[model samples]
Target: MIHIVFNEADIPVLQQAISLDESLQGEVVVIRDDYAVGPLDHTYAGEGREARLNWWREVLAGGDYEGKTDTGEVDDFKTVAELVGTLRRNPEETIWIWAAQNKHDVSGYYWLLHFMKEFQGRVFILYLNNLPFLSEKGQLFYPIWLHSIPPKEFLKAKKLARPITLSEFEVDPDEWIRLCQEKKLVRILEGGKKLSQHDADFYDIDLAKFITVDWQKASKIINQFQHKNKHTTGDAFLLWRLKKLISDGGFDTQGEIRNMKDFEIKLKSQHQAETA
Candidate 1:
C-alpha cells in the first residue's frame, strides 16, 4: 500500500503512526502544490501547468519564495504519473489518501481524484472531516490539519479508510472540473466536499483591517491576521497582497520588500501625521 497526503508537515506524523502500527506501513507521497489558490484550468496539461507556474512566479517575486518555484520541485503532474504507473505495474497494490477538513486538503483531494478514476476500487480515502481527536494534552478537538493529530490517534484514523466509490469517481471528478471551469481565484471549504469560490481580492479588505498607523513588521501583521481570521491563507500570498496594497498607496512601507522580515508597513495616515 502507498500513502498519499497533501501536507508536507503530515509526513512525519504519518510515519510515526506507521511505526506504532506496523499494519499501516507504506511509503508516503506528498502533493506539494496548494490547489486551493491560483489557476486550475487544464492543469493536467503542459500549457496550463506552465501558466499556473508562471502565476506562482509572479506571486513569489520579490518575496521569500522568489526564484524557488522550480518546476521540478513543485511538479504534482509528475508525481501523479509515477503513482499511476506504479498502480498499472502492480495491480495488487492499493493507495490510501489522507485528508484533513481544511480547504487545502479537500481541494487537493478534489484535484487528485480526477486522475484516479481508472483505479477507483484501489484508491481509498480517509477524510477527517468534523471528526474529533485527542490532542497531546488529552483534550478533545477537531483538527484542521492531520499533523495536529497524535500518532496514536492515527491508528484509529486508519479505520476510517474506505475504497473510493464508483459514484464518487463519476461525480467528484465532475465537481473538480466544474471548479476548474469556474476559474475563481480562491476556493473555500464550506462543509464536507462543498467548496465556495471567490474573487482574487476577496481577503484584501479584511487584511487591511490589521494595518494601523503604527508600523509593524510584515510578518507580525500576517501572524496576527492568521490568528484572528477564520479563513486563513498562506503568508507568501498575503505578503504578495500586502505588496499590492502598498503599490495602490493604501499603505506606507520602509525597507526592502524582498522578504517579510525585510520590510515594515504602516497605514498611509501615518505620513499625514508626520507632515502635520
Candidate 2:
C-alpha cells in the first residue's frame, strides 16, 4: 500500500501512526507543493508533461520560494510525476490518500485521482477534514487533519477508512478538473461548501499595524484572527504575502526579507496617514 499526504508536517504524525500497525507499512509520499494558492494549469496528465513542466517553471521562475529556484521546482515536479508513474505501474498495490477538505489537500487529492484514472487497484481516501474525533476528555470534535488527532486516535481512524467506490470517483474526476481551472481562492468548509477569499486583505493590513515589531509578535497577533483550521494560512505563507505587501507600498520593513526574525514590519506612512 502507498500513502500520500499533502505536506511534510503531516508525514511524521502519519508515520508514527503507521508504525503502530505493521500491516500499514508502505512508502509515504509527500506532494511537497501547495496547490491552494497558484495557477494549476496542466497540472494533470491530460494536459501533457511539457505543459505541466512549463507551468511549474513559470510559477517558481522568480522570487525566493522558500529559497528554491525554478530549476529546483521543475526537478521537484519531475520527481513527483515519476513517483506517481511508479505507483501507476503497480496494479496490485492499494493506494491510500490522506486528505482534508481544505484547498491544499483537496486539490492534491483531486490531482492524484486524475492521474490514477487508469490504475486497476483499489483507491481509498481517508478524508479526515470532517471526521469525528474523540479527545482525551472524551468530547467529540472534527479534526482538520490526521495530525490533529492523537496518535492512538489516528490509528483508529485508519482502521475505519473504507475504499472509495468506482462509481463515486467516476462522477467527481471532471469536477476536480474544473476546479483546477478556477482563478479565485477558497476554503472548503464542512459538507464540502467553499468560502471565497476574493476580497480578503485583512492579514496584510492587520499584521502591518504591528510597526517595528518582529514577525514572532506579529504572527501571534495574526493567529488570534485564525478561528478555523480550514481558513488558517500558515505563518510562512502569511509572511510571503506580507513581503508582497511591502513591495507594493502597503507596508515597510527593515532587515532581511526572507528571514522573519531579521526584519521588523510596519505599515506604510501613506496608508497609516490615510487611516489616521
Candidate 3:
C-alpha cells in the first residue's frame, strides 16, 4: 500500500500512527505544493507548466506562500511524477490518499486522479474533513487536519476508510476542474457549496485599518484581531497581505518586515487621502 498526504508537516504524526498499527505501514509521500493560493492549470504538458510558472512568479513573489516557488525547470514536478511512476508499476497495489476539504489536500487529490487513469489499482481515500472520531473521553471530533487527531483516534478513522469507486472518480475530476477555475484564496464550505476565498476573514483593508488606529506594532495588531475576530488567519498569511498592502502604498512600514513581529505599520497618506 502507498500513502499520500498533502502536508509534509503531518508526516511525523502519520509515521507515529503507522508505528502503532503495523497494518498501516507504507511509504508516506508528501507532494510539497500549496495549490490553495496559486494559479493552476491541470494539464501536465509544456504549455501547462509554463502557465503554472508564470502564475507562481506573480503570486508567490511575496515569499510567504509557504516559501515555495515554481521554477521553470520542473523541480516541483518530480515528486508527483515519481508517485505516478510507482502507481503505474504496481497495478494491483492499493493506494491510500489522506486528504481533507482544504484546497491544498483537495487539489493534490485531483492531481493524483489525473494520473490514475491507466493504473488498475484499487484506490482508497481517507477523507478526513468530515470523518467523526471518538476521543479518549468519548467526545466526538471532526478534525480538519490529520495531525489534530491523536494516534488512537486515527486508528478509529482507519477502520472507516473506503475505496473510491470509478463512478465517483469520473465525476470528481470534473468538480476539481470547476474548483480550479474558481481561483479562490481559500476553499471553505458554505450553504452546501464548496466556495473559494470569499469567506476569508482577513483582508487588506482590515489590516490597514487596524495598523492605522494607533500606529500599533504588527504583533499587537495580530493579537488584537485574533481575540476580537471570530475567524482568525495565521500571522504569516496576515503579514503576507500586509506586505502586499505596503507594496501597493496602502500602508507604510517603519522597519524591515522580515517577520510578522518585525514591523510597525502606519497608514499611508495616499490611502488616507483617497479615503477622505
Each candidate structure's TM-score, on Cα atoms with residue i matched to residue i, is 0.96, 0.74, 0.77
Top lDDT prediction, candidate number? 1
Which whole-number lDDT from 0 to 100 does residue 53 have in model 1? 91
Residue range 22-82, candidate 1, lDDT tens digits = 8998899999999999998987888878889999999999998888787478889889999
Q: lDDT-based ranking, best first?
A: 1, 3, 2
Residue 223 alpha-carbon offset, candidate 2, angstroms: 5.9
Ranking by TM-score: 1, 3, 2
lDDT of 1 at 136: 98
What number of clashing residue pairs does each candidate have, in the order they appear?
A: 0, 0, 0
lDDT of 3 by residue, 1-276 (tens): 888888877788788889989999898878665555444545467776677666655544544443455433335477767867776787767778888655567667776686665553377888876668766578887776677677777776787678887876788778767876665555544412254554333365565656763466777777776667544455555666666777776566786665556678876676575984
lDDT by residue for model 2 (1-276), tens: 888888777898888878888878888888766655554545554554455545444433333344353435434356557766776687678778888656677766766676666663477878875668787678898876656666667777786567876765786677665665664433343356243333225355555544443334334434553553225565555656566666776555666655445566664566575884
- Model 3, position 2, has a per-residue lDDT of 81
TM-score of 2: 0.74
Q: Which residue pairs clash within candidate 3?
A: none
